[model samples]
Target: MKQAIYYAQLTKKANEYLSCLYDIAQTLVSFDDYDDAKMYLVKISQYKITDHVIKEKAMQDLINVQRILTGLEDRYEKEDDLQKKMSLAEKCADTYSCLDRNERSKYYYLKQLKHAQELNLNEDQMATIYSSLGSIYQDLKEWQLSIDYFRREMSCRIGLGIQADIE
Candidate 1:
């Protein structure tokens, strides 16, 4: 009973943190103040939540802020004053807290595919790319595509020394 109560309290606290962070993240997004928003995001990164829906939503929000920041980069590029130009450019660069983890993972996955297509991809390379593409499709809810890629990956892995296990 005590353990359950403790867990409940912990869950409540986590919810509060997420709620507050969401509010702040959304609000700061409007200020043209990337620094402050990025700081708030970093602070909120401390809590580990295993909830997939919440995590996905939070990732989407972060991606929104990042897209806005990317749009603002052009403003920095137009600045002519040397000092102001440098400062703004640096701020623009710094605003990228990190690539969306999902995007980064997908990027590498696609990169492998490109490499495989460009070069003579051995069975192991094909297997790796197939596995990556499968995971990406799965996350995107393209179940058939995911299954197809996973199967291809497994089949390629079969003849190679390293096999991809799509879970």
Candidate 2:
């Protein structure tokens, strides 16, 4: 009980720091400083904030950063530095990857499909990935995969006997 309280307090503090970092990044974006904005976004992501609200906010911030990154990538026409261009592209993809494709999240279901094929995400990671997939499928009225992924997640949660506020 005491440990849980301590953990919660720590998470709250980290969340506050993340919020500050996000503001700095937003300011950089407003100034057309894409590199600095991306750097700050990555830094904020390193802050450990397990509180559901904070984590959700952080994920949303990542999605926003991804959009900005996309615009930046498009604006840069020079391709003299192949490695740098590749690195920037990868970072842009990674930014989108941070956002789960839930209803609240701004990601498309196709992102999860591409992710599952590209990365062999494990059960916990898969749960997050597949849940997002499930939600999108549900929205599109595609019942088969939606039911399959949802049941897979439910089975895993039941096996772990973990209390999940999935709904």
Candidate 3:
């Protein structure tokens, strides 16, 4: 009886969180405000719900909401500001990574690399890209590729006179 009651309470709390998430999504659609939507999605995604299904669905919704806000192809082409364009690409890469779509993440990361190179962004900025690529490759267990990217990142940091432990 106690177990049943505990489970009932858990289910009720989970349902409430799901309902709140759905309400936020509806509000986003109605307001057409991507920033606010992203904020809400971030909050919901970080929330700790005891239900696995609800948590998974909330994560998926967060990814979808982020994609709707970023709109890589459309926004990337239409954006005139270099900084904003780079930001969108980064957001796309992050969202894809969160979804475990590593290929898409790499695609956007490569795009960011190209943009950074073309715009002559500082070593610090480029290093961030290199570090991200290194992390991705490490996750993929591509040891040689990961080492190369990490080396590139280290080189950038060295160029900027930033001392870091190589170990």
Which is the leading candidate under TM-score? 3
lDDT of each: 0.58, 0.54, 0.69
Tens-place lDDT per residue, model 1, 63-156, is 5466555764576557666545544533433333233234334544554465456555678767776776787777767799889788888878
Candidate 2, pairs of clashing residues: none
Error of 1 at 62 (Å): 9.9
Residue 117 local lDDT, model 1? 60
Sorted on lDDT, best first, the list reads: 3, 1, 2
Task: Compose the digit string of candidate 3's lDDT tens values, residues 25-132.
Answer: 546645556576566556566767545666666567676666766665578768888878887788777766765556767887888877777788887988899898
What stretches of model 1 exceed 4 Å from their correct place?
A: 1-15, 22-37, 45-108, 160-167
Off by over 4 Å in 3: 1-66, 69-72, 160-167
Model 1 alpha-carbon miss at residue 43, Å:
3.3
Cα misplacement distance, residue 26 of candidate 1 (Å): 8.8
Clashing pairs in 3: none
lDDT of 1 at 143: 90
User: lDDT winner among the candidates?
Assistant: 3
RMSD of each: 12.0, 13.0, 8.8
* lDDT, residue 164, model 1: 42
Q: Write the per-residue lDDT of candidate 2 for residues 1-167, one digit (tens) a residue.
A: 23443554576576655566666666665665657766767765665544466556655665666675567346323444544443444444344434322332323334444444355445675566556656656765679868876876675556542224344
